[model samples]
Structures are given as structure tokens and as C-alpha cells.
Target: MTYLLEYSDYGSAGLLIPAGLVLIHLCALLSAFHSLQHVRTSQAAVAWVVGLVTLPYLALPLYWVFARNRFEGYREAIRDIGKEHDQSVTSIRRELFSEPCNQPRTFQSPLAQVATVMGTPVSQGNKYRLLIDGIAFFDTMLWQIQSAKRYVYASFYIIRDDQIGKRFADALIERANAGVTVRLLYDEVGCIRLSNRYLRRLTEAGVDVHSFNTRQGWVNRFQVNFRNHRKMIVVDGRVSIVGGLNVGDEYLGAIPSMSPWRDTSVQIEGSLTRKVQAVFAGDYYWAARADLPEADWQRKTDCGTTDSNDPSLQEEPSGLGAVCTTGPADERPRTSMMFSAAIGAAKERLWISTPYLVPDDAMIVALAMAKARGVDVRLLIPSVADLWAVYLAGFYYERKLAEIGVPVFRFTNGMLHQKCVLVDDSLTLIGSTNFDNRSLHLNFEVMVAIEDRAFICEVEKMLDRDFANAKRSNGSNRPLRPWFARAGTALARLFSPVL
Candidate 1:
């Protein structure tokens, strides 16, 4: 044949071409295998069909690399067994009591209007308490956990086995041991350093613990990016806590590393608690055993009733009341949309505090437009951030904001992990929704849109306290070695999407 004659004309042609092809094919196969392993099972199935139809030669190599190479033999066997023995179960007759959420009288609660505008009925009549600071938030939350009589359900992005976390775990265990159902869920990646032995102790003590997006075998390596970043605590179906604060020494400012962990959370009582329960339940389905039993966790509680002028509804009126939560699993959570509405509705001033501020395109546009409309926009960030990559990525926005009359300040004392937004001395949003792309689109996060003047004023006071110590940045405040720094900053900004 002509091709056979051409191959014969070259020296070592038989050896080189096939060898090179095999090597390149192996490399591509392995890379594709590893990438596919990181994806979900459903995604892997689709990828399998594509590879089989278009590149049949790659099918076996891809499958072997993805399914066999990454996991230990023993863990693989255990995970296979678990896939069959998942023991969660729920009865169809289980009474899941939940009332509709409070209606947004104004634009303060952004999502409240979405259903209404679509001709759907948005429930109204829930009560809310706009809580501030870690101590006030956690103390109130722990009290409710201790008081939980029927069942306790909670989850967080981060959970340390420290004092605050220990107290919470102990309370849940106590209730669980007393025949009150207790279930805890946390993100595996976020709490990677957290000891399973410690968690095992809680389990032995009676608490049911689960990790979100976690697997025991090779597939575990692939699911590291997706996390349940939402912080929530639903107690006895009557009360719930959701907000920015997580279970850590840093969150409590009790650890030496974080001397003053400034944060916010909200405790909800009334119709809103049921909505939070739904959010928690949906997450439980994804993270825990899908067959887990659902009981009628809802109960009647006299504290913090949904009365606009109730004396107990007043801040800390011998109780706690508020709401904060969002997640990608939910339908149209729209964290960014809620934030935009809050910013747009600002009548007097807008103040924001966050550890990271890598705003996405929409958030950047919203802030700029708010400034154009004459809102006094301000931002507070840590002077020395734990994550410099994100810090630098967010720095360029300071210059851009200053050009448009929006002031940005960096705190010098400690890491400012508090995620806060205060608007018009009337509306405030406090929770885990950072001004970043991950929070807006990827991570499960929570925030409360409060229309209470008292709470907003308190948030403004906190901002004022932070501003006094922060180093203000303006057009003329560029550092001395400006060009090199600017170049480095620009490079960082280019990769900001993933930071």
C-alpha cells in the first residue's frame, strides 16, 4: 500500500509514532478522568456517553483513571456498601407545620415581592429580630438549643470543637439523649481540620452528625469545591437561627488568633421559623441520608409572637427573633438580587463591612449606580487580611469607587470577618453573604433584610466604630511604590473571578 511504503521510508517510524500516540493518549485520558471525577455522578454519566460515542478508545482508560486510581481499596468497599444501606426514612403522614413568610411592606425584603409580582401569594405575618455582634447572637441561640424539647436541626459551613462549638454540640447531645431528635450537618471541606474523633464522641453521646457533599472514597477528592456554607439552627420547629456567625473561636473572639470577632446573626420566632425549617430540610436531603425520618417538629411557643407592637418583640425582650438564610438549592434565592434591592432602596447612606469584597459584575454595577444616584456608599475591610489574594483582588475596586465618590476604608486592628450592610438608618442586612462571586452564585449563604430603625442605628454605630480605626483610601492615597503594586494588583484582579 502507499501508506505502508511511506512508513517504511522513515527510520524508526514503527517505534516512534505509535509510542508517541500512546503516551499522548494516556496523558489526555488521565487528565479527562481526573477532571470528570471531580464532577457529580449525573455529570459523569453524561461525560461517559460522550466519550464512548466520540472517542471509544478512551472509554476504558477514562473509567479506570476516574473510578479506580484515586481511592483506597478499603474505603471504596465501605462507600459501596453505604450506598445501599442509607437508613433515613420519613412517613407520608408526618405533619410539617410551616406558615407563609412575612410580606415586604416596602422593598426592604426583595424576594418578598418576586412571588407577588408573578401573581403568586407571598405569605406575610412572620416576626424578625435584627441581631448584631457574636455574643448577643450566640448566647440567644444557645439558649434556644437548650430549650429545644422535640427536635434540633442545624448546619454550618464551619464548626470548630472549641468552646462555643462544644457548648452547642453538648446541648444538642443532651437533648438527643433525652429522646429529643438531634441532627447536625456541616461542610466537610470547610471543617477539614475538625476531628472526626471529636464528632464521633458527639455521635456516641447521641447526636446524629452528617457532612455535606462528602464521600468516603476516591470520589471525595472531586467534591471539595461545593460546600454548604449556610449557617442555620432550627429548634423544635418553632424557632430558628441563621446568620453570618459560625462555630469557631474566631467567631466568638474567644480564641487568641481572633481577639474580637465582629459578626451578626438573627433568631426567628413565629411564621418565619417554618420557612427556615424548609431551608434546613432541603439541605439535610442533599447532605444527609435522603431517607431520614421527618417528624412534626413544629410546636407552639408563647415567646416572640408575631405582633408589630408587642412588648416582647422589642430587641432582646427576654427572647430572640430574626431571619437570615440563602442557598443555591433553593428556587431563585437571589442573594445578589436581595442585596441590590437593599442598596437601591437606601435613602440616606449605605455602609458595608466584609472580610472579602470581590464583587461580581452585577454587584459592582449596583454599587456604582447607587453612587450615581447620590447614595453615600462606604465600605470597610480588614487592613491585613488572612487571604491576600482576595484582598488584592478587591483593592482595585477601592480606586474605582473613590473615583465615583464612594469611600472605602481598611481596618487595621484585626481581621474584619463581619459581613454587614447598613442602609438609610432604617434597613440593615447582617449575615454570611459576602460581597463576592462565590457567595452570590456558588456558596450557600444567609442574610436578614431588616427594616427596623433601632437595629439599623446599632449597625451604623458599629460601622462608625470601625471607621474611626480604618485607614481611608482616596485618589491621592496610593502607596509609594505605586506602579509595581498596581501591576500586581491588576494581575490579581484578572483572576478575581475564582478568588
Candidate 2:
């Protein structure tokens, strides 16, 4: 009777607000149920449920964008064209494994589990050079782009329209005009500021360029957060550069705010380069929806004169390595598992450097457990934060790990952007994977795992120099974060699932 009386008093026109509220709550209930069933982490599930149940209006849109753990569109697209990709992947694996991985007498490859997860094989006879800081950022990479004989392929997360970008554009335009096939794939979200004039200049020169649009077609309209963060370039499917440095003035340490911009990338060649090329092909296909017919799969990379007399150009044939490409499209959490495996495999010392350090609980436990086993585990994060939320959250994790005897160092020499890992004397990895939830779960990432003693030493010495410039902190003497930063830590935890 009261409901009827109120409806009559308000008339049909006033029912809109109440009707909308009922529908919103109903939708919230449905989303809450979905959260309970689909969310992988129990804590995240509970948080989502509580938020959706109490505040549906605000939480609904966020849930729609961030709650999805799987990249359904990427998987669906893969299913549409997976046959060719799978066959190629299988063929590559057989070719890689035909040459035995030269394992040490006692040490087994710790990356075996990672290889299984990525469905790729570790191959021998590969050569790699660790490119530290600005040494190889443009000097070597640009030279290779200029030296392209057949084709040039470049993919970056972010490309500025500044001086370095123009130089890079000039190289590709020159190559394309010379009848050398040139293609570029850049992340749309990362390169949102990239002007169309820059792209037009390349296209006018016959360069094929496309953005890796996160939201493509109807199936992917809701996936706004997934990003292609892989930074790699392959020339003629022979030589490749894969790692943390993207094409920008900041990457070259020219930007005053981000100067001395500490970063690392590697120029690798040999059979392993093919795997890197294939990974780019997959992303390029996703972006352009076409086969890269020009990619030379049959030709093996000759690398740098392997016989060069010049000291800077002389690089030895590396032993064994594999390229692990991972993303939200994967069935399992491959990036997190890969990092965990590396942590678990460290028998002597484990050192890692990344800009952000907000990892999940499971990864935290893995790091602490490694320390318990007497492994000299150390973490290097930036003293100057590039992303404030991620940096503040690192303080929380740093204290947590320190309580369990894992010390973290804050790199004081400008900003530390290198994503590197050193495991024992023969194992090391470099690429664009950060030790954070974003890289572990949300973003598309690629890492090169090398089991070459010579290359590993190069990485170790580089990190040693970084440690020398960083400040170490353990819970014992480290000061607590600011009271306001507690809010940032909470914010980090709340968004880490989707961030």
C-alpha cells in the first residue's frame, strides 16, 4: 500500500531515479557474483564483492574495465588464426632443440619451467651483447636500422616526436624509400601523443606503420587496460635488439627531469633472433591483421662479423637462450611464474633492478624464501619515482621484505629503468619486464633468458656499479613511510589487480 501511494504521489515521471537505483543494485549483485567466481586472488575477490555490493554506481564501470583477468579478444583472435602460428612455433621449437643446450655439469637450466610455460625451447649458438645505459641506445640501434638490407621491423611501447624519434623516423623513411621493406608497430596508449604528421611522413615514404590498438573490434572494446609493453626490433629476421630502452630523449638521458636515465637493452643475433622476430610477428599480426610475408624465417642470422677485429664490434657466440613472450592473453600467469622460477633457482646470489617493485604476495614469499636459503638476494628500485603510486607502494613491499631479511636498494644515480636479473654465474635475463603486478599480469611483456657465463658477468658488473650508487635499506634501520603514503599503499593494493 505504501509503495503504491508513493508512486501515485510522484507520478510516472519521478520513478526514473528509483528505477535506475534498483537496476544498478541488481547489476551490482550480478557483478558481485561474477567477482566471487572469476577473480583469481581471494583477497581481490573479497574486495571487489564488498565494493560492488555497497557502492554499485561507482564500482560498476571500474569492474567492467579492470575486473577481467583474461584478454578475451586476443585469445579469440588467436583462435581465429592460431593454426599457422602454432605450426610455426612448433617448427621453431624443433629447430631450436635440434642443437642441444649446453648445460653445465651440475647446474640444470632454471628457465626450463619458463620455457614450458611460454611453449618455446632454449637454443644454443646464439650471440648477445649487453647494451648498458646510452651506449647502444641509438649509436648501435640506429646504425643497424640504417644498415638494413632486406627489411626493418621496430616495435616500441612509447615513441616521442622529439629529436631521437625524428632521427629514427629518418632511418626508416630512408630504408623504405630505398625499397627496403619497413614496418613499425607502436602501442596506441603509450604513443597517444604521437602526432599524425610523424606517421604520415613515414607512410608517404612507403613505410608500413600501425598502432597496437588495445581496443579493436567489438570483442575488445572493454579491454582498455591491456598494453603491449614489448620493446624490440628485428632486422631481416637475423639480428635483434630487445630490452628496456624505448626511442625517446629521456631514454637517451637528454630530458633534464629523467636524466642520466639508467637503462639496459641487448643486441642479440643468431638462431635466437628468429624467436624474437616471431614474437614481433605475433604482435604485428594483432595490430595489422595480416601476415608479414617479407619476414625471412629460413635465413639464419650471421651476427656481427663474429670475427670482427674491432673491440666494440667483437662479440662472442653466446651459449643458450630463449625468448619468453607473456601477456594477459596467456592461459596461465607466465610472467610471474618466470620470475618466481628465477628466484627459486638462485643458489648463490640473486640481484634484480626495476623501476617499480609492487609484486603480489606469492612473489614476495618467493623472494623472502630465497633469502632464507642464504642466497644473496638484493632488489634495486629507483630513488626518484617515475610513477608516484607505484613508487610509494614499493616502500610498503620493501619494508615487508626487509622484515624477512631481504634488503632493497634505491638507485641514486638518476632513474633506474633497467629490468635485469642475475642468477648465479651463468644465468641472467634482460628485457622489458618489471618486478611489479602490472608487468606480471596486465601488460604484454618479453624477456630474453640467457645462460651464458660471459654475458651474465657483463650484467653482474653493470649491476654492481648500480649497487655502488644506491642506498640500501632493511626494516631494521629504514625509516617508515610518511603517514600519507599509507593511503598510497592501500591505493596500490586496491588497483594492483588491474593496474
Taking all chains together, each candidate's TM-score versus the true structure is: 0.71, 0.89
The residue ranges of model 2 lying beyond 4 angstroms of the native Cα positions read 1-12, 82-107, 116-118, 299-318, 475-481
> Residue-wise lDDT of candidate 1 within 444-463, one digit each (tens)?
67665554445556667778
Model 2 lDDT tens row, 45-142: 89899999988999998888888777766655544555656665444434333323332223366755455445556655778888888757688888
Global fold similarity of model 1 (TM-score): 0.71
Name the 10 consecutive residues with the lowest summed lDDT in model 2.
Answer: 96-105
Model 2: number of backbone collisions:
0
Provide the overall lDDT of each model, using Cα atoms, as 2-decimal numbers: 0.64, 0.81
lDDT of 1: 0.64
